[model samples]
Target: MSPLLWAVGSLLLLSLVYVAPKGATYILIDDNLDTELAPPFVLLQEGKALDYRSTTVVERLMNGLPRNALRPGLQPLVGLMALLDPLPAYLLHELLVRLAGLVGMYLLLRRYGLPGARHATLCAALALAWAVLPTYTAYGASVLGQPWVVLALLNLRLGPGRWSDWLVLVGFALWSSLVLTGVFVLAAAGMVLVWDASRHRRVAWRPVLGVGLLALGYLLVEYPLVYSLLIERQFVSHRVEFDYAQLAPGGVGAGLIGAVRYFGLGQYHAGLFLRAAPLLAAGLALAYVPAGPARRRLVQWLAFSLSILGVVALFCGFYPQLIGVAQRLLPLLRAFNLSRIHFLTPLLWFGVLVLSLRRLPAGWLPLGLVGLQLLIGLSMNPEWTLNVRRLLGRLPATEPTYAAYVAPELFARVQQAIRARTGQRPAQYRVACLGFPPAVASLNGFYTLDAYQNNYPLSYKRQFRPLMAAELAKSPALQTYFDAWGNRCYLFSAELGKNFRVAAFPAQVVHEWAFDAQAFRRLGGRYVLSAARLQHPERSGLQLLESRTAPGAYWRIWVYQVRN
Candidate 1:
């Protein structure tokens, strides 16, 4: 098939496999549902995306979260989200990210990996697989657009590069996050430059210049992060207490297992396309290739890829010890995760896929490999899986569609009920969620005392700790989770443990609730929108205001008022 035919075919497949399902029954849960989806939608809806003021507060979340705590709005994807409604914006973001990957990888492969028209179909196939790798849309093109950065750098390294190469560098830096992927990308680019310089015994000024441009772009785009971390010294972030030691594997065997799992399958947060098949394909290609430049290049890439995996594995394996020592000395190291370099490995593995495909002779073999990858990508995608299950009438009652997840009508009823009961609007009082994510409240325009925040004031964390202290005492694991990584500073239940998704079907009950109502009220928490019913609410100083249920709503929220 020709390039145009391949493109059209891929787009159709993307629509059938991804876009249609997403439009129909978008699954909203976990990280995407709680942390990422709401912020962009809320910010855009409330007309706060353009507000660059540091003092600006997003009143809907964290009892007035600083605007800088959310993602910066100086990107194309953010602009796109700003233009559309929540669901449409989300779908568009997903589509754009996928398309960007497909185009970028195809162009990169055409320029460097496979240089002829005969290889165009294979390039498209590989790129399509890369495009559909189930990376989180909230992250924009951080993982997918990596090939664009490489292409831009390679263009500069080869010669006086085109303006498009410079455009790619700047555009990628803007689209991606410095904290998430940009910093590591620059590091990788710098490594390449150093390696080239060492081999050639000379410096390549163009690629160096390209790298500098990309870094500068990141600085410009990530001004919010820069300002918050460096310029603003008023509030220390809760991330300062992040305890990697508690999370990391303990013994050598367990560490090795952790390393091996990560090296092979990758963490879900960082584009979790399993690398086993690709690694096997690469190994097979390396073994079979003739003794020549092709073999030499294959060997070099294999060694390079293996080295990266080895370093990442070892770092992950001994992360507890390494981070312990580093944090003890610096203390600043606790806030920032150095393990995120693992983010770049997915891109490297895909690159390996391209190389492995090129090494093989033209046949069904390469096509079969591409087909297998695409299948894996689709199967691994949570959204796709949920949609497929829903389509087959097998979706669990716990799993929610986009409509059911938000249930704007249901929340409106709750809002009205609260106002009728208290004679005050949602804005006049703060709320926190129990047995469910605060995202539901936040998304429905309620000012929440508790929220899922990647970065928030440490002072707020300290204040919030009191409310959950008794519950935390019962569960040492919950204590560590909240104190060390208090991202989800919700009202944790000792009975519930870490299971927050308390839907109506399970009929969850918290037997012995030890909530500090005084602390909750002091923090401006007027109501607790709990999915789990408390057996002894009076003991916790909570008056059951209303038990709300709506037709199509996932949660049977039992609204509890903190008695004065």
Candidate 2:
């Protein structure tokens, strides 16, 4: 098929197989809710882009905004979706981003001199694999800007021969920095430059100049914000640590095994590296192939892959305990999970495999492998298909919940109860969820006292540490509400009834032991909602106004008006 036809066909297939299955609208939950939905909602609805910085308890206690230095570049994309209803807008944004990555990947392969048909087929195979790959799909739906970052890196590798090329390169570099993934771009570009220089026995001035300009641009854009945040210690302090067992040789080995399982060549397995021996051998053989362009491309791919792994290894080796016993001290590492970078591993292997396969009789093996990968990916991991089907099925319903993280009917009922009880406008008063997820309150636009985010302010740390210590002293059961960092709260759990001390509240009011009604009121919370039954509904000055089970939900929502 012609390139145009191939492009069109692949685009359609991807949209149908991946994007459309998720439907036009779906609820965001967990990290997706916080990063993609809440922040964007704040920016679009309230015109307060920085509000997310202070939404967390620690951030608010700090008296100033927490440093939200990352992902500032996503504001425009979020803003563009303002007019469209949220679900469609989010779905559209995700689709377009993935499509851009696909196109960029194709162009990148072509730039390396891969033939048209071969590159197109590879692109299609990638799309197929990505459609069912949970990690890639999750990241794509997130606001992390990973896909755009990949696209930017591809553009950077195209080399800046024209003035427009230079403009695009610089623009993307600045944008990448704003999104906080500039580190990867910088690392990749720097590695390529060094490799090129070493090969030619001379400096590659253009790339060096480009790198300098990019760094200058990033500094100009982000340094001030970071500096101020560091001074206040308002930046996110969560340290991501990997078990030493999960690093490179072990983790990579497991991933290879998982990939083999994904190809249906082996039995289902848990470790990522189970059947990865042959695949690794194939990749290694390709890495040493004699074709000039293929060798160069393989070297570049290997360098990029190693650079990412090296960073992870350095973190695991240097800072095994992301945050030591002293909770006050900030962690050296910010991004917690290095495993997310493993998303690039498949692409790296694919690149090398394609180059190595170029010399083979090219009709069936590539197509067969692609088919096997897709089949195994879908068959072994049924959630991909199930999730897509659920999303699509829920779209026609009045309010569809994603993974049941937030029940739309329950959320609406809670919002109504709050409005009726408070006799105030929506979003006017702070709220707390005793035996429910904070997202339940947050999804309805209430400022929640029980909230969590990566960035917690120092003031909050100081304030909450003592309070948490006091509470834990009173009832050790409260330990369940606090994370290892002791800076965030998690009240929602199946064992909440067992873990929370009910007697902590003045009235027989439902309590999670982490916060009493007084503390709730102190934090400007006027209402406390519990999913579990309260021992004394009318005790402790809290008026139980509504106790009703939400339709289609198992738990009952008990809404209380806290007394002043």
User: Best-fitting candidate, measured by lDDT?
Assistant: 1
Tens-place lDDT digits, model 1, residues 447-476: 888989889999899999999899999998
RMSD of each: 2.0, 7.4
User: Model 1, poorest ten-residue lDDT window?
Assistant: 15-24
Q: Evaluated with TM-score, which candidate comes out highest?
A: 1
Question: Which ranges in model 1 have alpha carbons more than 4 Å from their true place?
Answer: 17-24, 291-297
lDDT of 2: 0.47
Listed in order, each prediction's TM-score against the native is 0.96, 0.70
Please provide, for model 2 over 277-371, each residue's C-alpha lDDT reduced to its tens digit, 9 standing for 90 to 100. Answer: 22543564464477788667766765665454445444433332332322225333333433233333444444544544454345665556556
**Would you list the C-alpha lDDT of every candidate in the order shown?**
0.82, 0.47
